[model samples]
Target chain A: MSAKEITVALVGNPNTGKSTLFNALTGLRQKVGNYPGVTVARKSGRCDCGDGLIVELVDLPGLYSLAAASPDEQVVTDVLLGSLEGSQQPDAIVVVLDATNLLRNLFLASQLAELNLPLALVLNQADVAHEHGLKIDTQLLSQRLGGVPVVLTSAWKGEGIASVRRAIAEVLNKKTKLARLTWPAQVESGLETIVRAVQADTGRAPSMADAQRILFSSDAHTSNRLGWKLSQRETVVRQARDQVRAAGFNPLAAEPLIHYAHLRKVLDGVTSGGAGKQGNAAALDRVLLHRVMGPILFTGIMLGLFASVFWLAKFPMQWIQSGVDFLKSVAAPALAGTPMLQSLVTDGIIAGVGAFLAFLPQILILFLFVGILEDSGYMARAAFIMDRLFSWCGLNGKSFVPLLSGFACAIPGLLSTRTIEDPKARLATAFAVPFMSCSARFPIYALMCAAFIGPLYGPGWESVVMVGMHCVGLIFAVPTAFVLTRFILKVKPQPFVLELPRYQMPKPRDVLWRMWQNAAEFISKAGTVIFAITIIIWALCYFPRDAQMAEKIRAAEPALSTHELQARTQAAMIEQSWMGRFGKAVQPVFDPCGFDWKITVGVLASFPAREVIVSTLGVTYSIGKGAEADSQHLRQAMQEAKWLSGPRTGAPIFSLAAVLALMVFFALCSQCGPTIATLAQETGGWKWAAASFFYMTILAWIMAVVVYQTVIRIL
Target chain B: MDWLIIGAIVGSAAGWLIARAIKGFQARRKGGCAGGCGCADKIQPPKK
Candidate 1:
């Protein structure tokens, strides 16, 4: 066992647990970035294969072929040929084939073998294969495919992984000769003629194998690399077409998808299952994809998911809040006499950290549901059901995955937009993704629900109201996308052609691992970014205190008891602080939205993020740092608060109409800082970020005004 | 108001410098972008 290393590229069809396998092998040695010249992320990691051999694994984006039609596919082709500038050629390629769909998986595998690269065939999900009563003769399959070693693996059960790893090491160490595809005679002759023509046109030399691939699958990058104009390509393609015809083959025929026919033959002979009838996957698909039942099932799934998020997050939210409060309480006694230290500890750090901590439950619950759906292979079914709806809204079906995931956070959702092949659809999905009513906006919805809607409506009705607010965000996104498509953006919609994979019970280990990873990421990210913003927000709301005004308010609070005294002191400080004055200055702007100066302060505070609205409201109503406290007392206080000037004068500033309007506005607005930052990174410019902000803010203002004006008139 | 304006100016300058430094680092890491290679050379066959 020498201490040696191998470079292996893991290739597979999308949703085949390629990532899960890569994560298992590489652990923490992963580095991710966009592939050169495209927005598709490239994930590479290194693993120490037992016996001191280091295996650097590159997990290429799952593509159906080496016949590169899209950027993701082109990436696979580029790395395999050692054409990508910053990347080295893989020493051996590990083709991960789904045991269930051996025919489809072998299409790309057979194509890769033709490139003369060392290859190992890994038939993954053997456990699933066995359960479904399928059998594979690995020896026969390997011998049929030029004697390449075939390893059967159940990535879930950790069965046969060591064999797969050993196969990869053997291929790399032995430099095993790859078995080339046996192309039909007619196709081979046509490819040869095109290769000769391409060679004669350019003086530089390329391998016959390389030239063949370039003719069929070369992309914009490849065309540029080969120094071939469209005219030249067209001439070559015409010659190839003529050759095919002269040999009595139809150029346009879909049958004999050339390499696929051979792969299918290999699959039919080697694998056995679902030969006579459809299996469990087909049975589940019957109802899940049924025209009428599909939508109903989707609706049920979505309701169940949202219900879980709402209920499951409550306990964690309370725990996080209590933890923050306890920390602040512990620090209070140490800094009693020091005013600046006291404010910095309790107001800046504690308040800011608490605001972020409260979102843990929402992030966890949302990812939990997403994990279950994705792992069970139901996400594709969901996309299939919603494709027509999304297409009608001028978005592609691929946009639905990211948008649904946006409920947890928009950053990853925006990243997931890479699945949308069409550039126009990708941008549109990114633009509209922020309107999916992310967890950051949950605090605003909760506050309005508790303050105005919850009591009058009851608990179940409040849940509906909360869900309705999310619906408002989603409802607004479609029309906005439609308008943007027609006027501002104007990218043609890409056709939706999503594949639904077979369903399996989500592996509990994978689900729990995902939850732990996401929760840790959420807490860590919140600690840094949100913590900094919270401190800035505290500073904005504190300081520049009117010395005389503070004294005047303190004198007025003397008659109050100890608890009341603390409450009054907190209020007086806020009223005399810089934030109060700023709120007063902007109060006129918020008047039409039916907000007074205090609510105006909350709105301003929420611009960095929407969830701060809850804490802002909590502080404004003197409900203490805790929102779980007496709701009635907070509501009464909010109801009794008066405005400096209004037509109705002294009327409750936040009537039902006003509260509803605020919720509607927050629902539609792109106020999350991370979303804006991601937009800048994804689009690679501030123009899109600024444009997104401008459009969302304007839309929010208009919608809020409309809701308030119409409702106030009715009342 | 004066201090607020000054703070805004400082923040803008700081953000710009950070952005510039990151760009410089990326440029160095990528080593001059995607296409500056000759992997796609075409071969000429011998005269028959």
Candidate 2:
């Protein structure tokens, strides 16, 4: 292969603007994917070297060391070591170092130099470094590090970025000499002995790169995978440690690790700055991450997100509604002669699918807020604040991000758990993720809220109740996690060590691309599972309808107008349908929870997914009109619906107690199929998925029953 | 007009099938020992 197509791996610590640099260089020329053999995703991009050369840049996940305690760090090991199949070892390694915190950032660079690869060090965030008045003699630093080239880069302002590209190009073009670590005499001897032992034992020479990979893979599984059989590996590491201690180089004990101490000493000698002070950014962090005010600020942020989803989306939703209405009108006269054909064409396909599609604006709005928080670097801070609360539930603060993301869709949220270093914590986060109120639950909540809460309180209360319902799910979910962790599954908790990335403006192209990707996934879902279910539901309520009985009903209700008689006939027809019978059969089970046969029917149909509950009510109340087809009018109709027989006390059947019980059930239930699939994938087995489903279903049923019985007794 | 439904479904299915097929080809092109040798590809690594 030509030198111009050389692969370059980018390695750095988190919050170092590594992603910013990637976007700057690639500029819409990137592909997002998972690394082979792991669920952790790999983002790669191609950038031109201002020559005929194309630099294929692979961005490795952030890590403090090669000690592969997390799935993410393991990826760093895999790529740098060239163990991953189908990927050639990177021809050059670019270590992105944060200039503001050069001491700590340089530790990884020092480690990378030991591998003796073609290396280029990019001093990222140079603008921040300069503002703090830090002056570094780059030539001296380079000479001390065996002449590795260094480029000062400010990724955000697009400053000195061209220098980084040129540095990588120079390294690939073989114009730059390779860099190697000038380890202390003792440490160097220890590594050389270990390398020889590995080669002798395995009957093959250990590549210097392979030696680095083994040292980083300290986790139990990775240690086994790398075939660490020499038993002498540990002895060699201890010997190296003894040498470092013997040097009388007692740096800060545990406060700064030994590698960091060495790095800090080297860095400070070559660089100088006045005591760094806050440059206005600290003021923002004070309010955003403050103990007393952070939660309140976060609440305001969430309120804005929810309000935008409901209010700002109104215009586009109406536009889509009118578009569907136009399709209906156009189809009506064209298929007049065949009533069955007309209903199937307009109602089954368009109306059923259209109702679900109308929620696209709402989903897009949700993504907009998510993108904003992510771009601002506030997401990491939010996760940090949540750590204290998570610790109480035997989970680390990192668990909060996955659960918060679950609100959008559980699949991607669950996929994100790879970032959590602890296996037990990752699994716990995955198990509790489905309990967070997802967008799928919005349809159910909107229907019930309109029917019960909206009219009972003001419109403002809709937002309040929506937020309150989410809070209820969140509050209950953690305790449930605590109980699960303590009694059902127990494991040691991992330490909370998170990197709060610096604040930078999110790239608009990335945000828009993410929004489009999410929208496409939602549309794909609507076409497959949602579309099939809608058709099945229409078939369920429509088949076995009687023309003879409809005529008889029309004759008997002669006083009623045509529209009224037609509506009554449809209701009569549905009451005699198979679905109505099935609802009645399951009525006894739900009687304790105060659900009538009609509500029971809705619940049964909602098994495929919870959002169908609204559409089910739409069809049941509309009689044979197939409630799943109408989205907007369904809520109003549900509010105006009455039980066949009035309450025993002559009150309306859908009492406040019944409404509360239903809400509790929805809050506790795991009713989404995609969530089940996601759980299965994350858990690596169906056992956890099945267990999650059964437990949540049983819990919801019990809570609903207790709520109804307690309320009935008090009344 | 109803054929639009047919067309859309066909188009989406074909697109999905093509995507899936491409993924399969890519996986095979790499040529691994087992089904899961592609695990590393699915992982999101840090961008350089």
Candidate 3:
């Protein structure tokens, strides 16, 4: 299997460690896409280099230079000038830098050594640059640069990653020349007649670092991504900016004054010492950046990360709810001799993909506490302690890391509001980080807090009503980010600057590879969007095929009571199919919240995700009693769901005021469907995801008719 | 056998509605997201 490979890439700058040396050279393999039409992220990974060769790597995103101005630095300057589309070019180039910010990471390794290519460097906090006393000789910075290979790594003391894989396999097995540097005879006599008029109008040669950056990069989209010769490359880049301003330089500051005067003669005696004051990251950023104990220690670390995702997913959500009810009672009597293969194997693939993979231990313990609060930098000091409450909502602190990644989902909190530069505070932090509560509303707030608020409020007020219904999306994401950035996206409030890095100690394999890459993208969308919305709500409640309500429930089953003949033949095959006649023709638009047509067909088949309404109420109450979801027989058929007529006739339909009006209609709705197709692709518009799904479905039906008429008038 | 168990539940609900209409025609030809949320980067393409 030797179809040979090389690629390389891994550039750096932002909190260098270049994704901990591409997760210490591709650990759990790797992938993470993007960079085509550009929301940037890219990632990639492969790494064999244990000789049979096969490196790949990629990584990219973090920029600092190669003069790219955003669209994630024009996909890291069109994938390091291989010119991006379906990428390839990167045959070498490691870069990585940051030995305690070595001269602004050597101005992006001197603009990636004038982009000639086959580079290597690394440096990476060589033990926080020898714990600040700094030394960094690396064989006199690789013999004053010409023979590149620098290394001296410390990706947090995993020391010199085998001298950065034998200096990227000796800069991909040698023979790469051009290290000339010491330029500036007014930028080499203004790039020698625009590098010989871009090598006599592009017959090759023009890469004197793309003829000294198209003579002073006035960034005409990086001179049409350096293809050149548009009208003899803008009349030889305006006659080499009038001969580099008649040799006195400043052809727009002659490429950062001749790359910091040839990095001050190759950093003199190749860097020596004198650093000191890291006084324990400024005395732990003085009380984690305190101004009155930093918003009370960032609201006691976000109420101990949402009360330890319901007290550490209560014994692994009861051992993944008794291993999805012992694989639905061992596929119920081996598909009990077919009632459409026992309703497609215990209600369409074991209660709609095992009730969304029993919230994979509360999504890997809330992505292992947001991957150790974003790898120990205390999530940018919780966006510097929620930048004074996201600056009274005109947003700042870079819209607090996409409103703290909408608690873990608003489509990566609307693609991390592309790190908020301010298209009206990134569309008012992507229309207020989908009002937060994400881990797909943690199993619809853990199966309505364990079959209706933890056995009548026990597990300590069922984790304080599951951290106040996951703070109903941070209490309506702070007055909907202050009335959508103060009167619908007006936006002027920018000031956020943050930084706060130094707090190292996080690597438990980068917090279990970011909690198994966000709990394997929430258990691979429980096999494709919760197994195709739990088999189209188990084929709209198992078709219009009632078979005479299974022969008057097997001739009124021996005076009923196999739990009332499996609850009156699963409530007369859910009041005769088509999802109970479209949940009784939208049961008077969910009749003031006390929903019935089985909680309005599990909130109309969980509009494409909020944990597919607990496996569509475990496929309308255990179809053939295979016990659809977290069984205790579908929580005693939702605690004997009743109310067949008006004025709450026979009581029960999960009472406690219809399970706190179905957890405040799933903590204020707009029932998912990929968070309204990622708010119509991050607000270009389906009129702001149809005004955020008709203002959160009329604020989840007026807060579930004021929490089910103020808790049925306080009981 | 009960019409091959109603032809394997109508061929598993017609292969989950033709893979959800070929995943909403590949998220409307990449106007993006059908990768049900952890987007895995590169979205943008809609603004013309």
Candidate 4:
């Protein structure tokens, strides 16, 4: 809003390093994922473009053309045409192009040239172009595009950034707009008639670019944006199409055909290069993308990633556990007088937070590997491999990223469904995304595996169980998607067209940043939502303390050891508490799954978040003073737990069947509140979200019972 | 006195959590993200 400030928009094709350049120029650490569609919305930041000139730089979503096809692309088209409400008409445009692929990249630039905005062309990825032996003549390119400023930049390497900043400053100050392309008389006349018709209909004249968009768009997206209905403008639009047809072009294809023709001439001698050595990448793709070998490699990579997360994070998890125990030891005596206060701080806050934080190391490691895979261009190949499997279920390769993102969290995964253009496909993918075993569920698996599976079987088997638990949801998700897309939704199959970026070394800085950010987010949630839930659960399990419970226990077992007596008293009080009564009431329903009242309580309390079960168990099982109430202790407590009542009284509660059943339930159940809310928003109503919830819960319960019953008999 | 203090502490924690839950429910009702996962923050409204 300042007179001295000018807004410049950064627009480019997907995967052209526009975000990287935006980060470099503005000094903002906007996430820079190596894949396309990472940025789904416009992000703006301020930069001092020298001479005391403050530039407000807006980074728009990457699009191939103004003829937008998806919502994400429509955002860019709307912003560029100044039609998006509350968005400023940019004072200038910065067209960021990939230096290695000038011909294709220039097509978009050519369309922007027609907008008559002050323009600067940034030939980004200069280093890659140079390595590929590409030589672009900036001088000739500038002259060909009406002497607009052109600068070469390797954004990731911070090379030529100063030149880019200077070029932007020059364009803003001089108001040097790029020369517009002259169209053939037939096309020009057709566009003019459409413009006149629009003005007459709305009593307002539209810019020529808007007129062109309305005349040539394959759909009614542009017309809708102009607030003109098809009934109002169908005749003029048809007349314009007739003129375009007479000009020897199809109305739908005219814009690209004309723009490319102009671009071909404009770049006649402005650059030269063979498309670099794809030899290395092509050879890797042979095995990585092979029908048989690719899936094998993907499975191997995922197994190794999970195993590494477990093995590498073991030490840090122990350290955190120790820290938790130490804190409890220090606080127990300090709040000893107020038994309730001691219980709240030690059993509720510390135990819950510690149990969640213990898994932080594993979560961080998982994020690190995910970031590396995304940056190394292997994710696209993974999606390519998955396309075959997904196709049978009517989902395409585009759903792979959203599903993969679900492994980290489901909210962003649901948001990323915007990239899938087919409404049925998008809806089905969103419905299945919550079944992807997000990191929140990892704590449950880790606790279960480490406590029961690892100690009993061995670490190697533990790793396999860990991997299998991660896959349990995915295994169910495929058929769930199949049912939704093929039977219920009857979604038409869409071809998966993905451009695989050239493989490169993963940048350690970006990878580490992603890991740190995700880890911090995990910690933040633990301190807030998980913390609050734990306190409430603790209160539910702790209050209405029977004043004579300890006396009664001592009278019932007069010869018991001091530790034993205290443990009995604590157990009795908890059993008589509010949560305990509710758990007992629900225990019969889960009895077939081999879950006792305490396990049932954990399951029921964790509906808000799957991770809360770990903390809930931590609080539920807290008995002795200054007990080692970390995950390790919680695991020990679970192992020692026995069926207190029922036909199977005094039997060990956490049998192999029970552990596997619990893990399976958490894997398949739609337990996270945020995920359910996101599903409702993404699917456009609460109907599908509610269906997903009830269906997944039912399936999980049935599957859990089957696992428990079958495993118990086998054992 | 200790019992009263414990009651107050527990009551305050429960109150804060309920308020947060209500706020989250209202946000989801309004078609906004439920807030913990950082999606709501990343999505900024278009500038005027």
Among all candidates shown, the one with the greatest DockQ: 4
Per-prediction fnat: 0.00, 0.14, 0.25, 0.63
**Model 1 score (lDDT):** 0.67
Q: What is the TM-score of each candidate against the true structure?
A: 0.84, 0.83, 0.35, 0.95
DockQ of 2: 0.13
The top-ranked prediction according to TM-score is: 4
lDDT of 3 by residue, A458-508 (tens): 765666677777777677867887887788777787665555567766767
Q: Which ten residues in a row have the lowest lDDT in candidate 2 chain A?
A: A30-39
**TM-score of model 4's chain A:** 0.96
* DockQ of candidate 4 against the true complex: 0.57
- lDDT of predicted model 4: 0.84
- Best-matching candidate per lDDT: 4
lDDT of 2 by residue, B1-48 (tens): 644654464356556645644554453334211111122233332333
Per-residue lDDT of A1-715 in model 2, one digit per residue for the tens? 4444678888887767676788787774232211111123566778777777778877777776665666767667767766665566688898888888877788777667656678988888888778778887888777767677888888878898888888888787764543454555654554576578776666666665455444333444443555656475677655644554665543113113546666665675788874465556688888888997988888787777776677777688779778876887788678877666666656655666666777788778777778777767787777777776778788756676677677766655676677777777778888888888877777666556656776787666666767777776788788888987777678477676666666666767767776776687668756754566555555566666687975797677667887677667777777777777777789889889988777888787776578667546544654454423333354455555556663544445577678778877887787765567557766777898899899888988898899889987897
Candidate 1 Cα outliers beyond 4 Å, as residue runs: A1-5, A28-40, A207-210, A217-221, A252-256, A275-279, A319-329, A450-452, A486-494, A550-572, A608-654, A684-686, B1-48
lDDT of 2: 0.67
Q: What digit string (tens of lDDT, one per residue) describes model 4 on residues A1-715?
A: 4533578999999888999899888887767776667787668888777877778888988878777777778778888888888776789999999888888998888888767889999999899889888888999999988889999999878999999889988998788777788898999999999888888888888889888888888678877777778898988889988999999999988888888888899889888875677778899999999999999999899889878988999999999989998898898889888877887898888887788888999889989998999889998788788778888988866788788778778887888788887888899999889999888888889888888888998887777898898889889999989988989999988777777887888889889988888888889888877888888888899877789987898888899998788767777888889998999899999999999988999999888778889888888887422244423467777888887777878989999999999999999988988788778877888999999999999999999999999999999
Off by over 4 Å in 4: A1-5, A557-559, A624-632, B25-34
